[model samples]
Structures are given as structure tokens and as C-alpha cells.
Target: MASAKPKFPAIKPGGSLILAWQVKGKHVVVVGGGEVAAGRIVHCLNADAVVTVVCPTSGLNPEVAFRVSEGQVKHTDRNFEQSDLDDADMVLVAIDDPAASTAIWKLCKERRIPANIADVPPECDFYFGSVHRDGPLQIMVSTNGKGPRLAASIRKFIAKQLPSNAGNAINSIGNLRVKLRSIAPDPAESRKRMAWMTKVSDTFSWEEMCKLTDEDMDFLLRYYPENKAPSFSELRIAQGAPDPQGVDPFDGSFGFSVGA
Candidate 1:
């Protein structure tokens, strides 16, 4: 008999890989001191990158000037030079001089270093997405350099639907998970813990989970050995928590079409 067609479709190419790059302790070179460059530097600093700005001091905007004055980033008070790319793990070009920017981009290409030349998508090795941050939680929206304003709007819409305390809930859950692991170290109990945690997660709302206490956790652990999670009603009663206020679900469609 002929082979039946596969149920799933083949992977589609041509899309950027959405990733959270770990840049901590790595060197990032920013070759401008304009407003866009200031924003790029801030993002790099947030990721704990060792940032250095190479621009004439006269070119620096107020924000970039303040960052330099505070000693947050090392500053080279001149235009970019070939030696600037020597220790750079990543490069960001935000200068208005297209010829200079293109020249630097070509150098980065020869050195095989990833670079993003602002306002020139063709020259960029990567694109930045509009990001929403809440503690350890981050939501990013990308339109592949086609519609950045729309991406920002989409990010704002998503942020409104999430509970304000969602990050706190994640932190609380992490701590509880660590405590649970310390209490149940037996290898054979792994599956039970896994199942119990899964059900518990499915049953609790972000707000309810954030309110979990030590006594509540102790009571919950009693059911772990049985490979069971407490029911939503049971947990609510134990913790005196209220039902979650639901956000209207997004229909997974955009109201308006977006294009470059």
C-alpha cells in the first residue's frame, strides 16, 4: 500500500527565530549617541552586557550623556574605528551617516559579528522587538521590521490582559517548587510530584497562586504523595481566596491589517 500523507505540515522557513539572547558579561558595541542609540544601550544594559559607546561627545543626546556621566558605560569620545569591533560580541549602528554605517556593517560581516544597522533592515543581522517587562516576565512582539508601531500596539494590548501580579505569582511558584523538591527527594516520587504540580497549576489562577502561604503549601504537600492536586474549590476554601476576574480572551485576530 502507498504511504499515507503525514498528518502535520512541514516546517515553514523565512521567519526570524524569536529568542532571548543571554548577553550578560559579554561586550556590546554601540556606534552612535543619538536617541535610538540611547535606547539600544539601555536594552543592552538591562541584559547586563558590557556596553561601550563610540561617538563624538558632541553627538550625544541628553540621555546618552547622562548614562556616560554616571559611568554606566565606557565611552570613546570619537567616531568609530576598526579596533572598536575587536572585542565586540555584538554591534549596533545607529548613526545617520548611511555610508559610514554601511562600511561598519561590511566590517562586521567580514568578522562574522552580528550587527543591527538602525533604519536599514537589509543590513541588519537581527531586529529588536517591542518588549513588555514585568520582573522575570517578558512579552515581545515582532513584525519582522515591517511594522514596528503596530508591534508596539500589539504588545500594549497583550500587557493589559495579563494580571498585574503575574510576575509575583511566577516568583511564588518558583519558591514553592524549590521547597517541594527539598521535601521530596526520592527518585520514585518524581512522577507523583510532576502530576501533582501540573494539576495544581491548572487549578489555580495567577492571583490565587500568588496568595499561597506556608500553611497552605504544607496542606497541599499532603496530597503530593497520592499524586493528586487539591481541587480549585478546596484550595479556595483553604486559602480564603476569591475566584479569578477573567480577562476577555483575545480572538487571535488583529483588528486591522498591518503592512510596511
Candidate 2:
């Protein structure tokens, strides 16, 4: 007899799927103007998308609009209709009305437009994740649309640990890469140079580097190779007092001694 096959629960008609879409230079339509909409807009802008906002009652905050309005996003203060989806490559429906949001979702599906429903995951084609940005580096976190708040909290924690000068360090490394490539044209030599550079970067304290001038950086890069890099751990040990175990102290505890 053939073995019986186990049946699994089927996916509902509408279910959330987390996906990463390359939206660079693409048109994204946002249909709301509240804080939620603002957050989505910021993410879209950071991804270099051309955004168009449609709000029947309100528009994006003036400050946000000013910062990103260099023809990247245009606002239309009117209720959304099927016609609005004509030129939109991607759409985000964050409106308060569930019926309207559902309507837009159906239209997007019919028109073959990718869409995300901000508050309703089942009605969304894709979902946006929490993001952290440091210069050229960007980190995105997703919870599979299960717990967005948790994702945001994790992003906040990571943001705290990331150095503020991380962007500058990345830019410096890029410039160094160009210079290193010129000197070490061979792939093997270039790999070795990059390894040495990484070691130097790891050894150098970003805080200390922030105080140094461009000439100081250049001098260190030229004078100190990885093998000759200064030892920060040694400096720290030198600054600290000798361990009590190494000293011939009467006892471990110390108190004020009276000249009795």
C-alpha cells in the first residue's frame, strides 16, 4: 500500500509576504499623510524612489516635503481612484478606511501593480521593514509582518551601537581602496593590502581618529603598516595600576591608617 501523505494548511486568499524590491528610480505611490505614511515615505525616499503622495484631507509634513521635494515626490490632495494607479510602479495604501484600502489592493492586483497595505498585512503584496542607515551602509530588519514593533526596537538598539563616524570610516576605506589598487595591481597583492587595511582599521580607535587631522591620518597610513601598528591594549595596561596580586601588600583591603 502507498503511504498516506500529510496535508498542510493552505495559504489564505490574501497573505503577507516579505520581499525586497529594487525600487531605485521607480515610481512609488503613497496613499496617506499621517505618521505611518510619513515613516513609509521616508523609507521609500531613502531607497531612491520617486514618490507621489495622494491624500484627500492632508499632505506630508512641510519639513519632510521640503527635504525630499526636489521633483522626487509630488503631492495630490484628492481622494484616490483607479486612475491614480496608472503610472505608479509600486503603491502603498495606508489610509484609515479598510474598504478603501481593500479597493486599492484589488485594483493593484488587477492592474499588476505591487502594493503594500500599511496596517493590513493580508491585503499587502509586500511589507516594509525597520531600517538603519550609517552613510553608505544600510541595515533592514523584518519580522515577516508578525511583529513590526519588535523589528523597530531591534533597529534602535543596533543604531545605538553603530559609530557615528562609521560613514566617514567607510568613505576613507573607499579612498584607500583606490590608492591601494593603483599600487597593488595584482589581485593577490590587492587582497593582502585589503586584509592589512582591515587589521589597521580594527586596531585604530575611531574616537582617537576623530581628533586627528588629515595629515595625521596620512602620516599613520604611510608610516605604520599592519605589523607596526601601535598597540592600544598595551597603552591601556600601562595606564592602569599594577594588580594587587603582583604587589606585596599587607592585605587586599585598604583603609586609612592612623599614626597611633
Candidate 3:
């Protein structure tokens, strides 16, 4: 009898994993000098990687070439060789020639070096994602290297929905998290406190949250003994009203009515 194929949940390529690679302070090698390469280089730089670009034509991009010339990056004016992969933490191939990029891709795979070949999925270990930065927070969107343009469009849409004060709000929440972690006695209690904190942060106004003083934080902690208190501040405004004085409604001074 034919058995039904075993069903397994399919995980997309860009979905979060139990373990993720850390590229901070690593060496990233780029094999191109065009605009695409420039974009990849920017991403690597943001990740704090020491970036190196290998290309033959200095005329491809003046800004990038100048940066390389100024020692901001390591540059080699030639095609890629196996030796280029030496000491490289990761490789990004964005050259105009697919054959050359593919060759490098194969070598990187063989040597177990993570590689991303621009516009080539089968040859890539990972792909660049569209990113939006709000102060220290970064939001990333990716279509698993399937549709970069679509990812970029989605990013723009999301950027509009984000609040103007989202960065400040995030900073406030982070500060709150540190305080909660320090006071919570057990790990389980800490997780519960963090959940309450997140709920409070999400519900409050940015202005009220930002204006919260030490006294307000104390009040919250005292009031909510079981849960971490979300910080808030009082809002005050002046209401327009006339003073208690005899004055004409239309004129500035007291006066008899015209009919009387």
C-alpha cells in the first residue's frame, strides 16, 4: 500500500532560527564596484564589518573607489581568485558577470564561507533585506531573496505607519526593561514582569511616557506590587476663561448697556 508522504511544517528561508550567525566585527568581502555592491557594502558597514572590495575598473564608481583609495576599505583591482577568500568571514558577489560570480559562489560553498550572490538565489546563503532605522532600532524586511523590490516597497509602507516618537518610546521601554531585570527575584517572575512592561509600554502615550519622572516610577511600582509599573506623567494645560471682574463683553472696560 502507498503511504502518504510525511507532512512537515515548511520553514521559509528568512524565518528566525534557533541559532543565528553573528557578523559583528567580522571581515566582509565584496566582489563588485557597481551600485548594487555599494548597497551591500553599506549594510556590511552598518553591521560593523571590516569591508573589502575587489574590482578592476576604478571608473565604476568614484565615491566607492575614493573610499577604497583612502584606506577606508581594502581594494584589489582585479578579478577574484581563491586566495581572495582567505581570512574572509563572508563573501558577497555582485559583479556584472554571472559566470564569474557563480565561480566565486561555488568556491565559497566548497570552503564553507557564507556567501550572497546578488540576483542569484541558488548561489547565496543569505540575501540583503530592506531596512529602516529609527535611532538605535533597525527594522528589516526580506522576501528571502525572491523579491527585493517588493520588500523595499513594503518597507516604505511600514515606515509611514511607524510613529514619529517610536525611537524615543523604544528607548524608554529598554530602560524600563533594565530596571525590571535588576529587581525581579526569579527568572519566571522576571519574564512575567517583562510581559506586563511590554503591555504598559504599548498602551501609553509617548509624551506621557517620556515625561515620567522618578516619583512617577515609584508611584507605579508601589501601586502595582505584583507587576512592574509603566511610567506616566501628568498633562496640564491652561483653559481660556475671563477673570472675575465687571467688564463689557465687547469692550475692555465696564460700561452701561446701550438700552439702559
Taking all chains together, each candidate's TM-score versus the true structure is 0.82, 0.61, 0.69
The numbered model that scores best in lDDT is 1
- Alpha-carbon shift of residue 230 in model 2 (angstroms): 12
In order of listing, the candidates' clash counts read 0, 0, 0
- The lDDT ranking, best first, is 1, 3, 2
lDDT of 3 by residue, 53-98 (tens): 9888653497677778677778888878889999899999888898
Q: Give per-model CA RMSD.
A: 10.3, 11.7, 12.0
**What are the runs in model 2 whose C-alpha is more than 4 Å off?**
1-21, 57-72, 180-260
Kindly provide the TM-score of model 1 when superposed on the true structure, using C-alpha atoms: 0.82
Model 3 lDDT, full chain set: 0.70
Question: Which stretches of candidate 1 lie above 4 Å from their native place?
Answer: 1-3, 9-14, 186-195, 210-215, 239-260
Highest TM-score scorer:
1
Task: Report lDDT per candidate.
Answer: 0.83, 0.69, 0.70
Q: What residue runs in model 3 are displaced by over 4 Å at the alpha carbon?
A: 1-21, 57-60, 144-146, 181-260
TM-score of 2: 0.61
lDDT of 1 by residue, 127-214 (tens): 9999988878888899988899999999999999988877777777777677779888888988876777888888787678867776
